[model samples]
Target: MRQLTLDLQPAAPPSLENYVSGSNGEALTALAAWLAPDNREPLFFLWGESGAGKSHLLQACAATCSDARLDPQLASLPTSSGLWAVDHLEALADGGQVVLFNLINRLRASDGRLLLAARLPPRLLELREDLRTRLGSGLVYRLRSLSDEEKRAALAELARARGLELSPAVIDYLFARVPRDMRSLTQLLRAIDQFSLEHKRPISLPLLREVLQTSPPT
Candidate 1:
């Protein structure tokens, strides 16, 4: 019997380079600039639909900063220098809203950077009016979803990074049959890669079929 071994450690840290900017080049550029030591912007807000790479960008930014917070709860804001990448800002509770509002003021005073992501713009978030206005005070960008061709390219790039040699035909097949969202697509690709490695077989159409048949749907 062949036992499957699952590598449970966290996946490699997300980086800015691995992110497919696609049509969100401007937003990507802004994020890169904000990471610089001398960026004048104290806050940046990013909003988009789910699976639009908001969390990926936030994590990438957090990886570069020594002191950073992701989706911070009601924790006390650090007074030291660092960036704060808050994902799903809309989900913050009333207490979180107050905390974030105060944090924004402190960051402004210290010239610290804050990056926030949400499904809707700051105006749409059910937060304090002052907090909403504060969020809008800085650079705001809407992350765009990748097009079909861009998604295909991204998938191919991801496969290459994972040392998987997926042919164009296989890529197309996955595109047609699998979920179009990158998060789901990447998860499926990882599953297929694991299955192939366990079976000691190269990734191919047949292998992919087997993996898909065995794996539960997303």
Candidate 2:
């Protein structure tokens, strides 16, 4: 077994490139259109189901905010490069609306941008009229869950990126024995990596089965 130490710190952040391009649709393209300076909106409302790559999109935007070539409009910050992410904005839309309103106003005055994500769309959030209107002003995109094939492909790429050799049989085992989705697959890969390291052995079907049988799913 290779004794390479997995840089767990670096692994903490999921790969954004995989998330954006592999979202099972042209949603990322639509998002790219919205990010264009001319097409850029002061407010952007993104909503989707859990594990639908919402965070990935937001992080990708934030990660590349400094790259003028990617988004020239994203050049200025605090004034123009402002980024706000709210996971459960719907739950606190009413109270949070005022704060967001002020922030948006300030960003506008300074020529900035705002990005927000939630599980539900703004109209259904039941917030203040003005806030609701503001949120509705920008373009909104809904993210859908990945199909089984998409999830498997994503898992394979994730495994490769992590320097793990996940055979087809192991992939099938995981898909059948565990929750068949990107999020769960990712967690399982991490667990397998850890188990392999601790046991000083390569990842195998028997070890994965044992791990699944003992560990609770996240």
Candidate 3:
């Protein structure tokens, strides 16, 4: 079976409103409250597997408040702004770990804020014990992947909103054949919409297979 390309098209901009929390609703709620201008929380760490919406939530906060975003590889983190976001912490270098440790200390001293997302939880992170403890010191939230039923409901809503019709069989075909992440599924749906329009064919399993054929092999 041919694989469909999901990353070619950029996803919709990440935003708090667009994120589907599923079982992680409580995490989302706390994040929203933390992003409030008046809130004084020092830091938050979101950890989960890839495609679990960790990046989305952090970016949503940064975009919503114009906060500085820190790179995982940066050794010299910014000291100008109290608000900062660091993504993909698993790739951070040792120098970065030291800088971040000090940065966290300062954030606590000044009541500044930091946002972090990683593939692992703080206790399990391969970093300095102090840094790991500092990361876990804040309100840590683990993002949960959406279940098939939740994804199906979201897809149905997306199809309805776009005035596109997707049969249950096509959706089942997608779940079985393609990546299960919401972002990828959404991209697939868009690709199918465009392909159906171009070929003047009804959306169907055969058409989906045809569309999948157009993407280069993985």
Candidate 4:
């Protein structure tokens, strides 16, 4: 019997290079310039639906700049003047909200950078009115989900980067049988590549089927 565990392979940390800019080029461009000395924007907030790359962007921003990834539940925040990123804005507790509220207020005076992401826009979040107002005061951008064509383009690029040759038939099978989200698709792509290498087989629909049969359901 053959068994597979997706948990054995940890996900790669989000980075700027891996992020696919489908309709998000403007927002991504701004974030890529986060550490530039000439950037005058002190705060940046991006909102999108689940799996729309909001959290991914925030994480990538933090990793790129080596900034402090603040905890949304922390009672206190650092006073240093540097970049700070936090995900899931709605999960913030009272203390964290107060701290973040004050942090945004002090960003301009201290020349700091703030990056935030949430499923809802700042005005829609159920937060303090003052905090919501502050959130909107900065540069706000809506992250758009990738269309099917853009995803296909990204998959080709991803496969090329990984040195994997995936035919259109294999990609079609992936779309039909697997979760269509990029994250899930990326992981499954890696899994199939590993399976093919382990079995010394070319990547094909038959191989993907074989792996999918032994592998757990998505």
**Residue 41 shift from truth in candidate 1, angstroms:** 1.2
lDDT of 4 at 204: 85
Which candidate number maximizes lDDT? 3
- Of 1 and 3, the candidate ranking higher by TM-score: 3
Using all chains and alpha carbons, the TM-scores for the candidates as numbered come to 0.79, 0.68, 0.83, 0.85
* Model 2, span 1-218: residue lDDT tens: 33222233234455445563555467677777666767546677678887787777777675322221232233232333445444456555333456566766776666567777778788886667777777878778788878777777778888888898888898888888777656556767887887778888888887876666633343
Give the better candidate number (1 or 4) by lDDT: 4
Q: What is each predicted model's overall lDDT from 0 to 1?
A: 0.77, 0.66, 0.80, 0.78
Q: What's the best-to-worst order under TM-score?
A: 4, 3, 1, 2
Candidate 1 residue-wise lDDT, 1-218, digit = tens: 23322243235567798677889999999889888998878888889997788888888886322111343455544546577767788777777777778878888677778888889998987788999999999989999889899999888889899988779999988988878987677777788788887789998887767765634444
Which pairs, if any, clash in model 2?
76-81, 77-81, 80-111, 80-112
- Tell me how far candidate 2 lies from the true structure as C-alpha RMSD in angstroms: 7.6
How does candidate 1 score on lDDT?
0.77
TM-score of 3: 0.83
Tens digit of lDDT per residue, candidate 3, span 1-218? 54445566667888888887889999999999988889888888999998889888878876322211354546456675768888888877777787788888898678789898888899998888999999999989999889899999888888877888778887888888878888787887887777778789988888877877754445
Better candidate by lDDT, 1 or 2: 1
Q: Determine which window of 10 residues in candidate 3 has minimal summed lDDT.
A: 63-72
C-alpha positional error of residue 51 in candidate 2 after TM-score superposition, expressed in Å: 1.8
What TM-score should be assigned to candidate 2? Answer: 0.68
TM-score between candidate 1 and the true structure: 0.79
Estimate the overall C-alpha local distance difference test score of candidate 4: 0.78
